[model samples]
Target: MSRFEKLSHVIWHCQYHIFWVPKYRYRILTGAVANEVYRCIQIYCGRLGCEIVELNVQPDHVHLLVKVPPKRSISEVLGAVKGRTAIRIFKQFSNLRKKPYWGNSFWAKGYCVDTVGMDAEMVRKYVKYQEQLEKQQEQLQF
Candidate 1:
């Protein structure tokens, strides 16, 4: 009845707030691209036995609230999500890897990740509030 995931020797709730952007911080993650990135991340994380508690794919970046297992290091989790998503996105949308970009890389080299434990609600609200604020900013520009 407990919420925490239980391994043979451990019971844990390792949630993280992960944010990463596209190469050059391009606003390429829109419409189909955003959907694809979200789907790919969900699939990849699921394969790793990780649970995505919340996710938001912004125009230039992505924010994910994921529950990772202790068996996998944070770097390993990021590698899997970012690496696999990049490959799949490039393959599905060939134009992304062509011309001026001159490379198949999709995500930037680094990411920002923070632990979301007792303060999970605060993080969730912050993410939601950010999206709302961004929306408002866009409205003002037009």
Candidate 2:
């Protein structure tokens, strides 16, 4: 079932599959760091009134299936998610800065974003599935 946002004059369900990697695509996200990243993302998204349908933090990247309000653009939502999570993760994991690759950033410069259409559940399952696919196989349409 889909839970939509109801504004004064409209009701909408906008879901997106977002994925991003660590700086330089390093596989630094694991153990405590991975858990903290997941927690920070959930907290940040919750603060924005966004629902995280599914989330997976791989060793080198992260994925999230989220439902956001129509009033906010994808960039705005991503900024909130990425920007805030970076701050939280950095603060909680100060040792990350010691690594040359990580430096002053936790996430890379850009991310992948795709809208979900009528079959939202299908997309959620796709996000939840653990098996990694080749880059070409991951090219999905909304």
State model 2's lDDT: 0.84
What TM-score do all the candidates reach, one by one? 0.80, 0.77
The residue-by-residue lDDT of candidate 1 on 1-142, one tens digit each, is: 8779999999999999999999999999999999999999999999998999999999989999999999998899899889999999989998878857737688899999999776778889999999999999999999
User: CA lDDT of 55 in candidate 2?
Assistant: 97
- The reply for model 2, stretches above 4 Å from the true place, is 1-3, 119-142
**lDDT string, candidate 2, 23-92, tens digits:** 8888978999889889988998888888899999999999999988877788888888888888887888
| Candidate 2 local lDDT, residue 65 | 96
Best by lDDT: 1
Q: What Cα-based lDDT does every candidate model obtain?
A: 0.91, 0.84
User: Which clashing pairs does model 2 show?
Assistant: none
What candidate 1 gets wrong by more than 4 Å, as runs, is 119-142
